[model samples]
Target chain A: MTWDWAISVLGILAGLCTTGSFVPQVVKAWRDGETRAISTRMYVIISVAFVSWLGYGLVIRSWPIVIFNVLNLGLSGVILFLKLRSAPPRRKEA
Target chain B: MTWDWAISVLGILAGLCTTGSFVPQVVKAWRDGETRAISTRMYVIISVAFVSWLGYGLVIRSWPIVIFNVLNLGLSGVILFLKLRSAPPRRKEA
Candidate 1:
């Protein structure tokens, strides 16, 4: 029982750290209005990944996973939006 | 059995997507040699999170989590290294 509790705490800590990490990125993007060094593809892929994680969490009935993924989705989405908005113009199609 | 298999696939997909997402970020930082827009705090926290996740995976005997977190650690580490190396000099004390 003690081992299980310890593992659970670890999982929660991991989830919180991963999810909260994005907050700084979002804040930086929002504040500086700069994302040139950030990768659009990375955020795009990660956003999709968060959705997949959320689904898995739901299926597994893990509240920590679900909550963290939801938060991740929001934070990552903000970064993606900022990146896209600040992106340079592409070549015009004929 | 089918449901379990499907769930496993989803979990794998989630792991792959999240782990693979960092590739573009690392590539961008490497190619551009500019991490001005990247958040140092975010990477630092995320790296720790990856370590925590790795520990949890090991405790749970979850190969998927272990594999993905290891990949994440490597990728996120590269980005963090670049970001720190490129960071502007702090104000010097008199």
Candidate 2:
């Protein structure tokens, strides 16, 4: 296979894997009903970053980049929303 | 700014954030001495994926992609190594 074709295939796989990385966190948050461990600041920064990535993909017409970022943005948004809705992890009274 | 420059800037930010997403898990594993919650299969898959991504970046001559994937590869490798070396989470006897 030509080098470009090979790397393109790998790039697609990488995109899928990278996006898939978030699946576990989403599943855990949904099943456990807790997102207290995830930092709000991190989520906020990531969401903004994903949006920018999406914009970058749109500008470049890169479907892989666009699709992955779209999914990531949604995943992070859900986690952030859940974090906000869920109460903080229970603390023991001194 | 030209679209290329704008998107490039955004892409850099996205790469950083995407790579940064794994930091929390790495920190937790190191601090708490627990990686039982993470699936070995998942880490294996991600490490391979990161390697492929790095290769893809090299082929494409994308510095942002290369740097991000290299860092991610290292981080995931560390977590995987620690997971294997550390004892598994203790189970309560029934």
Candidate 3:
């Protein structure tokens, strides 16, 4: 395969890894009903970043970029929303 | 600007956010000295993914991809290492 095609494929595969990394975080937090351990600020920043990715994907007309960011936006957005909705984690005993 | 250039810039911007997202996670986890709250499996997977990204970047000759994944690898790698080194979180009371 040509270099461009090869890298594109590799990029997609790498993106898939980064993209899917959030799955367990969301699934476990949602299932456990406690997301206070997660950092709201981090996720908020990430969500905005995903939006940026979305814009880039649209500009490039790249389906993988578009779809990846969309899913990430949803996953991170939900986590942020949950964090906002939930009470903070309690302090551990001294 | 042409579509390719525009998207490249946008992608760089987006990639920055995603790339940096691990910063806070790493810092907080390290400072707090408690990564049990963070999923070890998620990070192990992500670290492996970052390697894939590194391979992809190397193949593509893209500095952005290479640098991004390198930093990500270090960040995630540290978190994983810490998580492995630390004990699990204590059980919460009913």
Tens digits of per-residue lDDT for model 3 on B1-94?
Answer: 7767877778888889877887887777778876544666678778878999899878767899899889989988987887788865679999
lDDT of 2 by residue, B15-57 (tens): 7876786777677677777654454555677788898899898
lDDT (C-alpha, whole model) for all candidates? 0.95, 0.77, 0.80
All models, RMSD in angstroms = 1.2, 4.2, 5.5
Q: Please give the distance, in angstroms, between residue B63's alpha carbon in candidate 2 and its true position after superposition.
A: 2.5
As for DockQ, the candidate ahead, 1 or 2, is: 1
Tell me the RMSD of model 2 versus the true structure: 4.2
lDDT of 3 by residue, A1-94 (tens): 7878877777888778877887887777777776644666678778989999898888768898899889989988877877787856679999
Interface CA RMSD of each prediction in angstroms = 0.5, 3.2, 1.8
Q: What is the interface RMSD of candidate 2, in Å?
A: 3.2
Off by over 4 Å in 3: A1-8, A89-94, B1-6, B89-94
* Native contact fraction, candidates in order: 0.89, 0.40, 0.58
Top DockQ model: 1
**Best to worst by DockQ, what's the order?**
1, 3, 2
Model 3 deviation from the true structure expressed as Cα RMSD, one decimal place: 5.5
Q: Tell me how many residue pairs clash in candidate 3.
A: 0
Across B56-88, the per-residue lDDT of candidate 1 in tens digits comes to: 999999988898999999999999999999988
